[model samples]
Target: MSLHPVVLITGALTGIGRAAALAFAHEQARIVVSGRRAEEGEQLAAELRALGSEAEFVHADVRFEDSVRQLVQRTVARFGRLDVAVNAAGTEGEPGPVTELTPERYAAVFDTNVLGTMLSMKHEMHVMLAQGSGSIVNISSTMGSRGAPNVSLYAASKHAVEGLTKSAAIEGAAAGVRVNAIAPGPVETAMLARLTGNEERKTAFLASVPLKRAGAPEEIADAIVFIASAKAGFITGEILRVNGGKTAS
Candidate 1:
């Protein structure tokens, strides 16, 4: 990696994605923050610039191939190369049991969580493979490896993301490009509030974690920075769980 690598992050307007952008900026990495929200994206880019990191905001809806392609192209155009990519664009979708799952509901979750990840990796790898070096860190969840009751859609989507991350890692490994994922547990984010639905439910959920609390977004962001950095150079095709000991058993 260069002294100041160029990093591109999708779904960067809030939560873990937003925190990752800030973390990378503090490392003096040039960054491109992408999301559907133009206003928020621009604001994040400005904030990164204020930290003295070269930054830009690119509007991208990861669900669309053309949009993702343009996002990668624009990043390379502006920075000359893409050294890191964080695919954090995802949603909790409409949480419910398997019986309540409709095709629309499935598409709503899979499109963004699974298909979006695929598209992002597809385009990101194109540039990285040619460059012969890069790191891609995808966002996943602890539910990815465990069965959960109501949030079946979200869990299923993350399982697919892990599969994609492993497969992409194999494809990119020989080419000197690394692909991996960070599986977070319950984090303090807007999505968590929506997933749990109430303070009581939230407390119950946290109780399951050995930490007995929710993880802060910055904590996950710090892990992302390490996983995406050269410090984790030997790591690839692995899912690093940052779930507050939720999976320790």
Candidate 2:
């Protein structure tokens, strides 16, 4: 009902999620930053309010259904309605050869990256469908679209996210709620460092990209804001890639 949309971001304490929060704040959108860490969450909220965006920090762990459900409910309660939801909570699971993979490792990654996104979508959609207008963006990776060695679980999890986004989009389209995902390649985030693990490996990974460089979080954030904007009203079920030409070839 307001031109300045109420925005909710999960895993907002770091990486691309944090950047998206700042980007939306610059647009004067109301914000709710959700994370497992209350201290960091509250700090981010204060920072957003400092930027002139009305903000609140709602602690949430997407791996749990109740936490995610409470997060969406609290956002609606505080903001009067849900407008934009960004699912950015993900993990780079322990990398290993397929022969060395285990069930525990698989669940650890899927719980946060796959199941987490699903639960967030499930709860967010309930509110958006009832309101009859909203947008949801889930953060994915180039690995979602292509295969990668060692990080197969992470790749698979993101692939699941892509499917969830498209399925959710189709379900929400007629209800005036749009769902989409952003697939970034070699983003400059803590997760990237953890995945690459060393300078040499990081360099090699960047070289694989057609642009020969990693993308900044803010760059991906811009792409997300655009898709979440009314300018992209007709765009839904899209896995918008923001990977410096990583997939161009």
Candidate of highest TM-score: 1
Per the 3 Å backbone cut-off, how many clashing residue pairs does candidate 2 have?
A: 0
Per-residue lDDT over 162-235 for candidate 1, one digit per residue giving the tens place of the 0 to 100 score: 99999999999999999999999999999999888899999998999999999999999999999999999999
TM-score of candidate 1 relative to the true fold: 0.99
Instruction: State the lDDT of candidate 2 residue by residue for 1-249, as single tens digits.
Output: 368999999989999999999999999999999999999899999999999999999989999999999999999899899999999998998999899999999999999999999999999999999989999999999999898788899999999999999989999999999999999988899988998889999999899888889999999999989999999999999999999888888
Runs of candidate 1 exceeding 4 Å displacement = none
lDDT of 2: 0.93
Q: Write down the worst ten-residue block by lDDT for model 2.
A: 1-10
